[model samples]
Target chain A: MSTTSSVPDAHEGARNDQAPAPAPRGPVARPGSRLLHRWVWLRLSLLLSAPLAWMVLIYVVALAALLITSLWSVDSLSSEIDRTWTLDNFRTLIENEVYRNVTVRTVGVALAVTVIDVAIALPIAFYMAKVASPRARRMLVVAVLTPLWASYLVKVFSWRVVLSEGGLAEWSGLGSPGYGLTAVVITQAYIWLPYVILPIFAALERVPDSLLEAAGDLGAPTSMVVRSIVMPLLVPGIVAGAIFSFSLTLGDYITVNIVGGANQMLGNLVFVNAGAANNLPLAAAIAMIPIVVMLVLLTAIRRTGALENI
Target chain B: MTLSSTARRTLAVLTAAVLVLIYLPLLVVVLNSVNPNQSMTWPIEGVTFEWWRRAADSAGVREALATSLQVAAIATGIALVLGTLLALALQRYSFFGKHSVNLLVILPIALPGVVTGIALNNGFRGILGIDLSLWTIVIAHATFCIVTVFNNVQARLRRMGTSLEEASADLGAGVFTTFRLVTLPQLRSALLAGGMLAFALSFDEIIVTTFTAGGGANTLPIWILNNMFRPNQAPVVNVVAVVLILFSIVPVWLAQRLSSDVEAAR
Candidate 1:
């Protein structure tokens, strides 16, 4: 629509410019209007250039560098990247028991967190979007969003306090799960619950009440209505929420560090190799597990139109 | 929509329960801040303001807070510009790779921060041969923070349309004048909301900051992580956490208010 309209305006301006004299009538031809109006592609490119450069340079190039670095070998003694193409890092990842264990552990925790978050989020999101009054829904939204703004590390630390050996869990007779995979999953689920809820709630909001009412009037049970009508509609949202919890949990080392006692995930492996061991190539290889997982997850969900929902 | 009273009651109870559980850990942190026990054991030994006082006087906390503010401010400023431009271009133009551009903008955030972090870390140290510092943290933050600002501004721009700008142009207003007088006014609230979110995101971020901040720098989260397990400092960390949690409400509340205001205005 804008394109069609702008073309005539450009032509009209051109026709006026070709006139014998500048008439002191109609819209005055503003200076530099030629540059602004005549060159649509130029303006579009101008708008896009800075951000495109930033994204491509800082993100795309860096990501490509990481993949390239992963395939290269790192000199153990000097700790310098050899730049020779080899699959040793990938080979080591496959052969090493520790890497295999951590990879499995990370994927397991991510799945658990995703499932837990989706389960909790569904009921809360339904109540917030469908059941609550407008005023109450607004308050609930604030309640959900406010916690997200709280510091991530601080939230994890609070969980550390709660799940400590002689802390709230023990004192309250829940028999503290101490700190490990369970702790990591619980803490992660707690932290990411809001991220999961918001998308499902947003999706539910888009599901018109009339649709549900129509289903109900058609003699469908409430469970059937949800299963056939609402649940299918919520697939995109649930997938979006799942993506958040899963990918977030996949890359989280901080939660694991604060809560996981004597356990490591893929993130911790990357951090330890990159930071302590000074092995960037190995860390890059470790990083690939999450990258590939996320790419696959994203591609799978792309067809569901969940990426836009996100 | 047609649930029984029993089901409705159950759903309400579950929501209330989840909300309580959500705030429970935060409540513990608030209590522990005042808890006299340095280890922050449950069933507090006694109440004391000592930790709060120490946190106030702590130089490390102050420096970390300053560093965090500086990084967040710079990163958010950069994100605001880049994000707004990207939003305008994508919303207004029919261009090739438009979908790809959208994906690229979202990629940093959608992908795990750890991957983004280590990738940038390697890029800076290995490929670029630049030393890591607070600036690297800012760069890494701006990369991901772009998405939040981009989403907010893009949503606003889509809703705004180009009618007003076109009208201004037809009236012989220059491009700069149209943008300043027309577009900027409409975008003000969006920019504010996005900027606030970007600031909050940058402020609370730790994972990317971890790899980017390198050895010498400390953001508030980094500070808390380092001091969290230290003897006697745990209580002080709790005090900081309490303060942070309380302070966080302002941006979230403001963003909510601004967005609702936009909705109401419409």
Candidate 2:
């Protein structure tokens, strides 16, 4: 209905376009043409300026400030940030055994979660893409996406209940791991499964069934066809999924606080330093670990074209 | 490839099983909200609506819900404008540092949430010389929420070529008028889908909100975190979670419907 009304406006505008050069113009039309048409750069700049300023001034500058803050030191007695620059925070991070242990633990858990999610997502994604009816496939997508909308804290808290003493695990006869590194891995994998699945499902959908049928017709076994065709195509999507789970798990503090019992990760270290200890410089330094790890992962996977898939 | 019948059955079974496993804990949460046991024991003792009644009457819960709604709404609004602008600029113009702009849009979401959180927190308090408040949270959320809106609008713009807008421009309609009448209607469904996603992302977000929210501000996620371990408030928290889970379906379904409608139109 609105489309029909717009058509008449377009026709009226076209009729005006056919008129002589001295046709009456609205008060706003002249500058609007000068701003939007006569000067292309002006138009582009206007469009780009707000979001670019937001990204640069807010995000980029803040990130740079965090890096610079990591080099500064905090006053011991005053708890004031000493403007004088130093590498003491990084030095402390290097020398501290606890930080090292936490870094190792955080990386290990992130990798575990990534691997578990991928392993689970593959067969399910393949089934959804290839085996399900169109209606069922859409239903499956919604089913997967629904959990992602569920509250992250609530999901983790639910895991805490399941892992607590005399909880669901005990009642189900699969005894809880009692809220530690293992609990963190399980809960994180569950929370991030949808993230992993969607990308893989999208990649799998792109694999043509005709090609698969041709492979079978040409006397290739199902396993050979899957290995040669589907798996390779799935790589970028899988990596995209892996990046999400890995990065999310790497920076998680709330999950650890909820179900990790006494265990702490890089996130917990940063949170503790920034919040309870009021040491922003040390917290900034601690944050560099995940930032560096993610940068490395992203750089390594940039060649995979998974970034676009993300 | 043609899977054998046995393999097909196995895969179907596996998928169903995983789906069940995914829903089990959520089911537990829903049941726990009604469980009469204060401790939330596994076996059902008796069902009651006591926790729901308490949650409805809880002042803290009411305030937190208001705060969350306000933050998510404002963040979604800001994100819609900035994200649409960014998407139009990137999609329509080939400019220098274009790839950099793309990367910048993704960085907030790609990097760890804690990293983005603390970076914004520092930028707000340390550099900007402002105290943390609900507005800081809105800023942080809008930053990341830009990606969803950008991705959706960019994809829509890519699919919808410049033909109609060009035709409108050729017809002597001013730029803003053409955009208002022609381009915007095309982008409406995409904006809705993206905005819905951004709202959901903001509503459920906690990590960044924790860093950016002031001492007095308590969003729903923050409230949930604070009350999760409290002995008397735990069941009420479950009731809140149940309500959230139930309400969550509306936006997801609406977004899905809008997107699918667009897809069918295409």
The A-chain TM-scores of all the candidates are 0.88, 0.90
Best candidate, lDDT:
2
Candidate 2 C-alpha lDDT tens digits along A66-158: 999898888999998898989999999899999999999999999999999999999999999999999999999999999988889889988
On residues B52-137, what C-alpha lDDT tens digit does candidate 2 reach at each position?
99999999999999999999999999999999999999998889999999999999998998899889987887778899988999
**Residue runs of model 1 more than 4 Å from their true location after superposition:** A1-33, A302-310
Lowest lDDT 10-mer window, candidate 2 chain A? A1-10
DockQ-based class of model 1: medium
Q: Comparing to the true complex, what docking class would candidate 2 get?
A: medium
Q: Candidate 1, A223: how far from true, in Å?
A: 1.5
TM-scores, each model vs. reference: 0.94, 0.95
The true-versus-predicted C-alpha distance at residue A81 of model 1, in Å, is 1.7
